[model samples]
Target: MAKPTTEVALISVIVALFLVSTTFASSDAPFIVAHKKVSLNRLKSGAEKVSVSIDLYNQGTVTAYDVSLSDDSWTQDVFDLAGGNTSKSWERIDAGSLVSHSFVLESKVKTMFYGAPAVIKFRIPTKAALQEAYSTPMPPLDILADRPPEKKFEWAKMLLTKYGSLVSVISIVVLFVYLVATPSKSSALKGSKKRR
Candidate 1:
């Protein structure tokens, strides 16, 4: 019985040391800091184009492998990365490293507004470490529209389009009241002949 207890205690100590070493090793995993910016360009046809710029920094001791940016809002057909992307392998991002990428997305003028919500997903070395250092609800980019100046004729046309029917109806009523209130020329002549 004494020999069995000694063996059990030795095994427990070995397991504890292994766990402690593994924890220390994983603590040096890579950490990622991400930032994004969005901008809008108004086309000559009155359509808007969206451009997104992203910057990622690896602020850790180990290299981050397979780093990529992904979002459901990114339309596969219209999305264009600065450099052509053929595979998910982005090489490796070393410690204290900075990487920048830009993408041009499809135009969504009517739907795009100030402080629009967007989520960016990243593939990093360790999800837990990245999440701990990552900040949420990033500042939204402004959508600028270079609208043409409104002309006087355009304002007049808009007013007519909105209130033209009301104006016509009022004009007709005024004409009818004026005709009823005024004495006719023929009646005036008859009255003058009777008085003479």
Candidate 2:
């Protein structure tokens, strides 16, 4: 009786360990290794250039296939891929391997504020995986139109740039009007003496 009880306990322990190991193994499947960087570059024309770079690693023991990256807002007008179409693809990423992709996109500064999120999609023999990469808020562009003057000097510069000619013309007209309206002091004194 004692021997049978010991055997049963040993079997139960083995079964628990097996279950835990299988769960861990499944959880370690192919997934995004990391989001290396996402950044925005502001252009002088009040447009924004966006770049997203990411690394995809296969943590599982099997190769990943049909890997692609997508963003709903991505279009031919804005994104020009280095080689492929709207959805980037890789035939296969081997087990314990990493792949890097960089995307360059262009848009108006205002449009970037409503940009879409990026997603990684890949498939394995057993199933497909879709993961969302770490997204950074699109940085506001510092274009001349969007950024307000921070210093008094900047404000003065902006005003001069915008209204310099108008201001100068108005000043000239005011000076001419004053000169025509006011009689010379010498002329007024001469007339008064003549009258006396």
Candidate 3:
């Protein structure tokens, strides 16, 4: 009876290990990651030139199919698409690959607004349903603010304020090391007299 119980326990353990291994092996699905960046420049005609770019990466072992990117964070009344379309589609994104999309937006009105994250949709070969992901959200921005360019003196002042104390501390430490490492004049003269 005891021998039979031991065999049953061993069989169960082997079965559990097999199940765990298969579960890990079947996780070879495609994972999509996205990041969005926006840069604002004041155009000469008093309009805001907002250049937006989205970077997508596939970090899994399998390929993603029917990839679509949509970003409708800004409305037509507030902003206008100056260069590229807001939505894009791709046939496939292989593993360990990167894709990027960029669009230029132009706004004439001065406004402070918050933006939303872009949506990404893709399908895995083994899965029937589409998987959805989002890009990192952006912080609120004050477009067309009266921010003037810094002068040369202002740059110097900024550096001084940021590093003046650190420079002083480092100088003091070097001076202390020099004083400790070098013998004093009086000590050198005394040693010479003793030698004489």
Candidate 4:
């Protein structure tokens, strides 16, 4: 009786762990990641450029399609960010029913650069010209959540800009220690001097 009960419990635990692990597994789960960047030129005129990027993956037994640089408000148009990359792409696209469709973006950028960039919203719908792409619903972002946090990694900036004196003193101390550890030129020459 005890042995059977222990076996059942062990089997249950194994099944539960397998399910949990598979759920979080990278290859098994389908996910998409997007990287967007936008910049604004204070001196430039209202001229703007836009860049877009996309990455799609289908972990299940179906194909993902119709990937687009979709901001219905036409927002990603940034202006005068000289020689900047505005769009991103995936490494490669795999083929198969459960295949993932990754896309690269190169449209406009100035509009998407700021969260308040004319309030452009991005949506991934299930529209397709070749394959039936599934629609992915997007939830509204928290009004304040998108704002940059008041506290930031600003300490590094302070060290770079305002702590120059401290950095210089530390560098001087390090140089002194290095010099003391090294044999002096006079000492090295003394051993070879024949008469002097």
Best by TM-score: 3
Report the lDDT tens digits of candidate 3 across residue range 96-169: 99999999999998888678789999998777999887776665668898897758698789989999999999
Q: What is the RMSD, in Å, between candidate 3 and the native fold over all Cα?
A: 14.8
Question: Can you write out model 1's per-residue Cα lDDT over 64-129, one digit (the tens) per residue?
Answer: 775655433444443434343312224677889987766565443444242322332334544643
Which tens-of-lDDT digit does each residue in 12-62 have in candidate 4?
567546644664773432233322333222223333323332234443322
**Higher-scoring candidate on lDDT, 1 or 4:** 1
Global local distance difference test of model 3:
0.86
Cα lDDT of candidate 2 equals 0.61
Instruction: After the best TM-score superposition of candidate 1, give how far the Cα of residue 174 lies from its true spot, in angstroms.
Output: 63
**lDDT-sorted candidate list, best first:** 3, 2, 1, 4
Best candidate, lDDT-wise? 3
User: Who is ahead in TM-score, 1 or 4?
Assistant: 1
Q: Could you give the candidate ranking by TM-score, starting with the highest?
A: 3, 2, 1, 4
What's the CA error at residue 176 for candidate 1, in Å?
A: 69
| Residue 115, model 3, lDDT | 81
Give the 10-residue window scoring lowest on summed lDDT in candidate 2. 135-144
Model 2 per-residue lDDT tens digits across residues 136-186: 223333322355445858878999999999999999999999999999999
lDDT, residue 141, model 2? 32
| Per-model TM-score versus the true fold | 0.43, 0.45, 0.67, 0.26
